[model samples]
Target: MAADMAREVKLWNDKREREMYDNFADLFAIIRTMEKLEKAYVRDVISSKDYEPECTKLIAQFKTLTTSLKDTVPSVERFMETYKMDCPAAVNRLLVSGIPATVEHRASSSDVGTAAAVAECVQHFITSMDSLKLNMLAVDQLYPALSDLLSALNRVPQLPPDFEGKVKGREWISRLRNMGASEELTEQQARQLLFDLDSSYNAFINSLPKSA
Candidate 1:
């Protein structure tokens, strides 16, 4: 009976380890995504308005995940004390990962004035795109802002020399130009174009230089 209990406890401890590992992995992914956002914000690839809110949201999620991990630690500690077991492999692995340090370092590095301004502009543009009401007035408002964003993105010095070619050598811009001049698109087509533009904009954002 003692041997059976030990085996059962071992199984439970292993299960908990795996669960912890999974949560750690999820938190790591979120951290990486936040890193991407920070890099874009720093390099003027995104706007502050967009970056601040998005960063806040991700940080909240990160906090919640960490809290969950913290709450589990006491239980794991009790299990260790009761069973005379060392730390589980998952927790040990997490300690080795050093995720907290990584997240803090990445976020701190991106705090710059110019980047903050650009990040704000990117956010405003995104907001403007989202605010379109499918009416003629909205369409008219969107065209100039869309053109300006495209122009600004193209001018960002951090973009690689061949960036345009990689994104089909300004074909996306041409699509925008055509739409801008013609203004013949029905409401549905206009909305779809805005969606496409957003996709293109994000693709550009992701293409900017990644942090080392």
Candidate 2:
């Protein structure tokens, strides 16, 4: 059954599904590392013995992603190498000897002023965005096949326990202390203010993921 499943995987696989799975793997890795290090600093951070089971599941999913990447990446690279479909001559023609060349030549100090540079830059920026949008639209039509290959390319390093709150929290506390309040706030007043602020910020952050 495992061999049958491995042989059935294809280059035209559903990229979005694989991407979502890869994202799960990434988050799991981060959570696993983060929790492990946190426990080292403040012992007994996660009291759950079930964490081992979660690790087992994460490894199984990761193996599936790794197998898919091994099959797909080389095939995609081969496609790009075979036909040069990625950077076609037509796209290059935009810069090779035409409007692009004129713009490049116009960058000479004698030919263009600061204001003209700004204008040209704005025009180029607009052109670039337009081209990018069109390119993505075409790519969306093609099969959304960017996944599985770059599934695990970039791994964000986990925070070490000692550096977690020690570095950033200390810096922020110093900045807050340096602000020099009119008088030292009483414990009750500070607690009330902090509670209110936390409530407000939590609400704000909660709204962000959906609205952002």
TM-score of each: 0.35, 0.20
Scanning candidate 2 in windows of ten residues, the lowest lDDT window is 147-156
lDDT per residue for candidate 1 within 85-119, as digits (tens), equals 44333232233432222333345565343344334
TM-score of candidate 1 relative to the true fold: 0.35
Query: Which candidate number has the best TM-score?
Result: 1
Q: Which residue pairs show backbone clashes in model 2?
A: none
Report each candidate's C-alpha RMSD, comma-separated, in the order given: 15.7, 24.3
Q: In model 1, which regions exceed 4 Å deviation?
A: 1-51, 54-117, 133-139, 161-184, 208-212
**Best candidate per lDDT, number?**
1
